[model samples]
Target chain A: MVTYIWVFFVIVGSFFTIFTGNVEALNNEILKGGADGLKLLSEMLPLLVLWTGIMQVAEDSKILELFSNLVRPFLCKLFPSLPKNHPALGYIASNICANALGLGSAATPFGLKAMECLQEDNPCKDTATEAMITFLVLNTGGVTIVPTTVIALRLMHGSANPSEIIITSILATLCSNVSGLIYDYFKRRKKHG
Target chain B: MANFLVPIFVLGIILYAFKQKVNIYESFLVGAKDGLVTTFKIAPAVIAMVFATNIFLNSHFLDFVFSYFTPFLEAVGIPNSILPMAMVRPISGTASLAIMSNIFELYGPDSFVGRLASNLQGCTDTTIYVLALYFSSIKVTKTKHALSAGLFADFVGIVAAFIITFLFFG
Candidate 1:
């Protein structure tokens, strides 16, 4: 799946730019791609490190277990295949909590940890499990409540009420999450049937 | 609120951990080491995805495709200027952010388009990027329905953003 997407990007992007008479920019991006990736990594690593460290404390102290226990009912419904208090559940809860707060990058470490825990139970190393897919659906659906980045940007741009769209953002995010979950549910049913 | 959430959350975790008699500093170092290892582990995948995505974005393919649909979209109250942001959103967050900033610059952040862009930014995550990163990190080559489901959610999010924006700000 990733193979096809990368190929499509390279082939289509190069051809389109060349045909559009902007080969220069495409050349620049291709060359700068790796550096940009590194720059992004450097920027992201700090938060991931900090959160992973902090969450590690949370995990070690069994704080995560307590937290996950609180949310187990809701998470169990979303991830029915997993045991009642799977280790991944705590990480999943942490990831969801971080994500919902709009600490977008800060959420990645917990999410990565969640994936690692989920992978432990994955029978086939190279294939995604249903639980993994469901978790990804929840993660990528962006169930943000504050939209700190957007609000901050608006604040920078001198808006009268930068956070006014908080309600609207929440509504839209709810729609996305609900819709994604519904789609995932249907696909799960079909696979079983 | 986000400003305070981090400190409060961190304090809560620390307090809990301390009460639990956990070796906080040692555990933190161990986890931080794991974080570093994991960061480097995924660096290659990050580079690969970023390379392809940057190429795609720099090509301005969405601009070309959206140009053809601008008239129709604008006729329905969707600003042509915001199309690139919406299209690039699920693909690349920074690209959408750049476009959103441009929109704010061009037509003040208080405008309907600006509000719509704000909603759009909040409504969906970068589905393609997140999918690639997560699955590739685990070396999962066969992602059956993750892509479709994530993109489906993004599509719904975009539409919802439009409706919610119009309802609230328009």
Candidate 2:
């Protein structure tokens, strides 16, 4: 599935570029894309390092255990396959909290940690576990109520009502997250049956 | 308000850890070291995705396809200016953001199109990038239904954004 998406991008993009006589643009993007990726990684590096470090303190102090236990019931419902006491549950809760606060960069480290923890118990080592899929769905489909960047961009552009779309955005994300969770639920149910 | 959240959250965690007698500095260093390792592990996946998405965007494929829908979309009161942002939203966050900024430049951010862009930006995430990075970091090649489910959420989010934006701001 991932391979198909990448192939579609490269193939169709090149296919169109060849016909449009825009090969130079494509060539330039191809050459510069790696650097851009590095730039993005660097932009995110500080947040990842800082939060993971801070969260690690939480982990070691049993603070993480307390936090996870607070949300464990809610998480258990969302991730039925994971054990109640799994360490991944702690990271997962932390990831969801960061994501909800609209700190996407802060969320990635926790999500990665959760994935690593999940992988520890994964039977196949190569395939994704059910809990991982559900976590990804929640991460990708989760609420971003603040949309701090979007609001900031709107304000930068001198919008009179920069935050007016907040309600609408929240509604839309709720739709997405609910629908994604429903789809994930049915997918899990079918597999079990 | 949001600015305070980050520092407060960090400070609160440290205080909590200190109260619990955890060696904050060592714990942080250990985790930060793993953070470095995680970053390098996901670097290849990020580069691969950025290359593909950049090439695709540079080729103007979505723009070309969207041009044909512009008139039809406008006829139905949809702003064609936002089509690029919507289509690119799930593929690349930077691209979608660039497109949103462009929309703000062209149509003014308070315009219907701009508000819609804001809503769209907040509606869904970069599914492909998120999936690739998370899965690849853990070396999970067989992602099963993760991609499909994420994309489905993106699709629904896009539709919901359009509907909610029009109803509220249109």
Candidate 3:
């Protein structure tokens, strides 16, 4: 239902731009965009491998368990139904950690795993549960500390001070996460009531 | 040379020390394989979207839109130089990155608009990519509400990045 509206919006937006004479510029943009995309894909490959390897090692070492224990008190407040030793909890922690470091590419598997684990415990057959909703909010507004992808882009672009945005990124993410959590809390209350 | 070599040597020693009896090499290979698989799964959508965004920007439509958006963006403390990147960001991360780099090169990194643009890049996701990948992976055939909400979230991120930078840095 809602998806239709979204598609409409994208179509309209694209058409609107095209009508405004941008469509004529498509050939150049396509070539440049392809080159840029390929470059990014290439640069990201090695870093992706490194981080994925590290995450696997972390999993093998039960380091995620230690990290989960460290974050438990805070996570409990956010996800009360999530048991401390639950597989979902560990995955959630790893996802949050990876997100915080701005390694979203690294976070995807953990996010998927968390969702899978949560679904296993879901009593409802179809709809997403309260925990799932909360997880979605958290992931959507996940606090980023390093903003690595942005930094990489900046560096690629020739920024003299690529790292300077770090402070602003931290503050903005903090605010968004706090507000998003508040929104989730109020929305959940309405749903339950 | 020493500055670079020292860190490499230290990292090598650490890796060696941390090496366990387990077949770490095989495990790493498996993980890499999985990552490649995910990348491949996303390849088509990513490529098409990237091409589309490139066309949009190159076609001068972006310039036309930016002219109208200039005053509004200025009100939010985003200079004209940063507008293109901000507009492209929601559609494509890599492209926005290219624009960010261009701005950094032109204005120098410490300039207000340059910093703000870079910050906005960090703060937001490629909204379309998120929608395409996550929902598709879950077999979500419908995404109307999610799309609206996600785009709204991105709008908030962009505005917030600008305002926060203005308040703090400007």
Question: lDDT winner among the candidates?
Answer: 1
Error of 2 at B82 (Å): 1.3
Q: Which residue pairs clash in candidate 3? A: A2-B144, A3-B143, A3-B144, A25-B59, A29-B54, A157-B101
lDDT of 2 by residue, B9-52 (tens): 88888999888888889999998988888888888888888888
Q: Compose the digit string of candidate 2's lDDT tens values, residues A1-193.
A: 6788899999999889989998787778778889988988898787788778888898898888998999999999999998899999999999888887788888899999999999999999989999999999999986797888998999999999888888899999999998999999999999999
lDDT of 1 by residue, A125-170 (tens): 9999999999999999988998999999999999999999999999
Tens-digit lDDT track of model 3 for B8-74: 5335433642664445566567656655665555555555555555554455556676798888878
**TM-score of predicted structure 3:** 0.73
State model 3's lDDT: 0.65
What TM-score would every model get versus the actual structure?
0.98, 0.97, 0.73
DockQ of each: 0.84, 0.78, 0.32
Best by DockQ: 1
Error of 3 at B47 (Å): 5.0
User: Of the true interface contacts, what fraction does each candidate have?
Assistant: 0.82, 0.76, 0.24
Q: In angstroms, how far off is A186's CA in candidate 2?
A: 0.6
Candidate 3 C-alpha error for residue B154, in Å: 3.6
Lowest lDDT 10-residue stretch of candidate 3 chain B: B1-10
Q: What is model 3's DockQ versus the real complex? A: 0.32
